[model samples]
Target: MKNYDVIIIGTGAANIVADAAIADHKSVAIIERGKFGGTCLNRGCIPTKILVTAANRIREIREAAHLGIHVESVHADWAAVSRRMWHKVNENDSIRTYYEQFKNVTVYAGTASFVDKKTVRITDANNHTEEITGTAIIIATGGRTHVPSVAGLQESGYITSETFFGAAYPPEPYKSLIIIGGGPIGCEFAHVFNAFGTHVTLVQHNIRLLPKEDESVSAYMLQQFEDYRIQVHLNQDTLSVRTENGEKILTCSDRTNGKK
Candidate 1:
């Protein structure tokens, strides 16, 4: 059994607590099941937004004709976009190296679960297990997408934000995309993929996209999505998704009147 003054599970925002403890001469163990940085850094925010920025530029150029400025043939290379984004995020070794530089800190890569209060077990990739006990253990395991229980959806190979951005080889720029859930992530992806020349259809169960935002703002954003040539299907629940003849098709029901 390994012993430490502090055991911080998940190298995310919560793991920053170890910095102060380590500064006070306390030995700390930073446990992470995945990469050194958490979701925002590795998969979610940082890298995805960078791609979004590039997409925005493409949209601007394509729309430049309306501004009386003729910028011809502005194209977005999506495979290049996905490739470069991952290349940049995966290339960073600063976080891991910085943590390793301190003799008082230890980094463990494995799945961690509590055995008892103040005791935890970590199972690595090879299934090798080890127990670590600490005076204080902090769990900062971040969130993952929760897929809903829908018939044929899972087997249809539907892609979520995580799998799309986290894959080793992302899809080679599909010509069309049907994105469900028109909240922030879905809207952002709608903009990105639409800007990348993909025909995007955004479906939302709510009456409008961005349900959590102000009503006026949501309406304006929906207008913007329409202006971007994105097909918007509001107040519709996806009944099922199935691949038919080498193409995936999504069936939906109008939630307002309970009709398909």
Candidate 2:
């Protein structure tokens, strides 16, 4: 059994707590199921922003006509963008290396489950198990994409934010994309792909994009989406997704009138 002054379940916000514990002359143990940097660093905000930056640049160049600067052609090199994103976000090994350098810090690459109030069992990829107890346990495990239960969604296959930036990331921009949900992630992806020359259709269960935000903001975003030539479906409830004749198709019903 290994013991520590502090045990952190994840490497996301827990990193800050670990540093604090280390500064206080405490031994720290970090157990991570996936990548060391957790969601925002590994698969979420940071990587998504990298792609968004490229998309924004392409949109800017294409829309430069308003400033009397006519750019004849705007091209997005998806391979280069993807390479840069992967390069910047591939810091898992480095994070582990840095943590390992600290004699008082131990990094475990695995999932952790509680054995008792202060003790936890860690199971690694190879099914190896270890027991560790800590005076202080910090559970900073982050969030994941919530995939709704819809017919044929799983069998037909789809990518969430996790897989979208991971090994399963497509080599080239998709020719077309159907994005469900109208919150930040879906809308951002829609803009990015549409700017990169992918036909984008965004379906929102709510009547407006960014439904939680102010109505004016939603209205403005909807207008901007229209200006970008991105298809927007409001108040839509996705029924199912299927692939037929080598084409992916999504079936949705109008939420307001319940018409398919």
Candidate 3:
């Protein structure tokens, strides 16, 4: 068992604080389960924003014709986008190289679970086990998308924001997309797919889109969604979903209008 002055679990915004701790000459060890730079850099912000930017460029070129400016067809290549995202991710975060360069910090790529108050065990990539005893531990594991409970949802194949980022664009252009939640992730993806020529239908349990945001912000976004002709099913509950002849049929009940 090795010992350290401080151990940090996540490496996103908390890493900034840890850097400050290191500058104070406190011996530190960081154990990350996945990539460094945490969720924001690895899965959440970076890749999504990359896709959004590409999608927006395509949209702009498409609208140029309506402004009396004739433009050639807009194209988006999935493989090229994926390669660029991967390259940027690698350049921004290389954990192995960091450990080699930093003498004070010991990096272990593993699942770290607490055995007790002062001790933690990490199961590394090669199934190796390492134990560390730290005087202080900071847990910065961020939030994950909450896939709500709906009938027959678990067995049905679906994608969350994390998986969606890595997913290759559909081989053929899809005519329409039905997104389950009208929250940030869902709405953002709706915009991306819509820009790429897919009609989008956003379903929300709340009366307004982006329920958790400030009411005024939500109202503004709802108006934008309406302007974009993104179909919304507000205050509706999904009763069931069944795949029929390779198409998913969702049965929903509208709570506000008393329609099923």
What's the TM-score of every candidate structure? Answer: 0.94, 0.98, 0.87
Q: Candidate 2 on 90-185: residue-level lDDT in tens?
A: 877798788889989998989999999999999999999999999999999999888988899998999898888776788898999999899999
Shift of residue 20 alpha carbon in model 1, Å: 2.2
* Model 3, span 1-260: residue lDDT tens: 88989998877777876787777777788888777777777778887788788888887787788789878777778668767767776654665465436667887789889999999899988989888999999888887878778787766666676665456435544677789888888888888777777888888888988888999999898887788788888998888777777767777889877688
Best by lDDT: 2
The models' CA-based lDDT, in order, is 0.83, 0.91, 0.79
Of the candidates shown, which would achieve the greatest TM-score relative to the real structure? Answer: 2
Cα displacement (Å) at residue 221, model 1: 1.1
lDDT, model 1, position 157 = 80
**Which runs in model 3 stand beyond 4 Å of their true positions?**
65-68, 92-96, 125-128, 167-176, 214-216
Best-to-worst order by TM-score is 2, 1, 3
Clashing pairs in 1: none
Error of 3 at 15 (Å): 1.9
Off by over 4 Å in 1: 168-171
Worst 10 residues of 3 by lDDT: 164-173
Order of models, best lDDT first:
2, 1, 3
lDDT of 1 at 78: 71
Q: For candidate 3, report its TM-score.
A: 0.87
